[model samples]
Target: MQSWLDVDPTSDFSIYNLPFGVFETRDRAPRAGIAIGDYIVDLAVLAERRLLPLPDHAPHREEDLQRALNRPTLNDFIALSKSVTGAVRLCVQQLLMASSRDAHPPEVWAHALVRQRDARMLMPLRVPNYTDFYSSLHHATNVGAMFRDPKTPLLPNWRHLPVAYHGRASSIVVSGAPIRRPRGQIKRDDDPTPTFGPTLALDFELEMAFVIGKASPLGRPITTSEAEQYIFGLLLFNDWSARDIQKWEYQPLGPFLGKNFASTISPWIVTLEALDPFRVPMPSQEPPPLPYLRASGNQSFDIHLAVDLIAPSGLTLTVCRSNFRHMYWTMSQQLAHHTVNGCNVEVGDLMASGTLSGPTPESYGSMLELTWNGRNPLRLPDGSTRTFLEDGDAVALRGWAERDGMRVGFGEARAQILPALDGEA
Candidate 1:
């Protein structure tokens, strides 16, 4: 589909991928925006002009629809039915088409379109809850070999169910935010006693997270076949980790201070409808999962994932190249398992596919696996080496799927690491 605007075919936000986010200009407040190439289509202005599909599934009053899009987050707008949001997406796509240029007034187009560079993209939603799942077999196997018996890498229950933990939704931030190195209890392999200080091993986990568009009642399980109805879209996620703290605190219980420090996500949420063409069959699961977790048809996306690290010296390096298709467990399975015990989910809740490491050294997702737990260091182009992140280092995660000359992507989830605070935590 050709847009009237000059959208580079190689741009992540091509006409085929109109991702949604919240943005604000100097004179405007936070409002809903649709990204296409280099511009942000303002939903508030479109609603005010009656160009968008308002009142069809939303408030009857056009002003009310405008007000809803003018909010600080997309949660309220997403709480509406999928048909409503789907209509909005289709309407915007139609308006941007080259053939439809003469159908709309120039004044209306001028007011509704804004360059992305002129606006600030904010967090797309207010997350009610966040769940992080260890669904990548390679990542789990690598971690197990490093810490557990190499002969028996996976735990007894791994192949049966998706292992996951509830993460801190409050700490999640939008891209370009700075991540402060967490200060916590650290006890190395040789240290007799645990000490409290800045983490010696700080890492970033490359992940893809899905947003829940609809809510489910408590005490009811969202079956595998029904899980997709609740999922809204996907976002690139960077779940930061403090490996030293994780090793010390994660025992009978799961991670605590080791995680929950901070995580970064791309501002835009790419809708599943935009990514439908790139769907692929999920990897076959051995020892077939229970009925509740069994899913039919294509359950995986062929999204290519990569991670780049910028050193303090200003050199950038591609440290990891992985794929979402390598995940052993699918989103359907994760959501089904999560609610099988009666855990209710809310709109805007996030569920992340844990580190998506592939079957190679360069495909490892986290520094823990890439550097083999700080033993093997990655040498950068500037001759500097990195086992884990240091102060002023920046990490960015990018994901995309392409076929038939079309690309749908999550632009970037980038963040710089800041020095620890003056005092200790």
Candidate 2:
């Protein structure tokens, strides 16, 4: 957990922590690098140096490893067993750990690794399928209250198990991509005619998405015991929504256009192993779940998550704050349920935990819930009020786990709204 690199120990990127990512420089194509302070430990160059030692069971050929790194997907790389992952992390740490002055100088650790500013990061993995689950009781209840009576906040089945719907993977974009305003149908209760135009009720859902690295056969259900084996890591996700369109179409089927327009995810996949120390007890269930969804032990992660809204005029507001521990259902349960019907899950499939909201208003995960379905407008620093997102407004999601002198982080997922298309009505 130490590196020879001359990085501040307190920095998010440290030699002890080499989070892998895909990046490209002015002169180089996309390749893998380990974040170390202000620089990226170029894995392609490290491979050329034979500095990367593989675990005994690692897949053969540096070329395969390089190919996996260069490809848009991180699935192949993550499918490598824990032993292989550990070996690579250990070697990278040794190469960057501060060296003894007599043994070697700090500059000795510096190699062809490029500075962060000189490199551009790409999506860490190419997602094959995406599924978003409604796992947060607080968020679900708060949202349900807006449409249903407060006394009957949750649907009968909501407390029994996790509710999820498959989402479009093709529309998932990397952070920094512009989320073009989506167009859809909207009808007010009093309006005689429905209107089709850019969304007026655009918003962001703050949640964590896990990347699947291993596949399960068509008929086999992934047992809770084996769920972690299939998981690679987690990233912050912004499941952007168009509430207006959603309300009109989300009757017999769940969300379609409202939830699928443009979802955003952070670039780095913070490995599950790195987050092991931050594990917490899963929230208690009201009525016990079915046997397939039950785990003998507690399961959850203690990750702090937050969302910020920035106006076009440079004003920023900390909109929401919550923790992952608030989830009513575990990821293992969700995965088990997903495949209970003989559905095959492959590497690169992304599973998102729906808005991780807590109990208080300040912990609301989305503007829709916080504003009570647009009844209460959120006041911004620039003296503007907003019940929903406005064009040109940007939303950013961030998450981290802090404990025992270690900090594991998922970088921000940010997107700005563009004006809706004109003359569609």
Best by TM-score: 1
Tens digit of per-residue lDDT, candidate 2, span 1-425: 54545666557664434677788888888877778778887776767666676766666667666666565556677766556656776777676555633354344445557998998888777788999999999998888888888889899999887899999999998888989889988887899987888888998998999988788889988877788888877889999999989998999998998888889998877778778888888878868888888885657999999999999997999999999999888989888888888899988899999999999999999999879889999998878999999988999998888887787777689988888777754
The reply for model 1, stretches above 4 Å from the true place, is 54-64
Task: Write candidate 1's Cα lDDT for 324-354 as tens digits.
Answer: 9999999999999999999999999999999
Residue range with the least summed lDDT across 10 consecutive positions in model 2: 100-109
The best candidate by lDDT is: 1
Q: lDDT for each of the candidates?
A: 0.92, 0.82
**What are the clash counts of all predictions, listed in order?**
0, 7
My TM-score estimates for the predictions, one after another, are 0.98, 0.94
Candidate 2 Cα misplacement greater than 4 A, ranges? 8-10, 99-111, 423-425
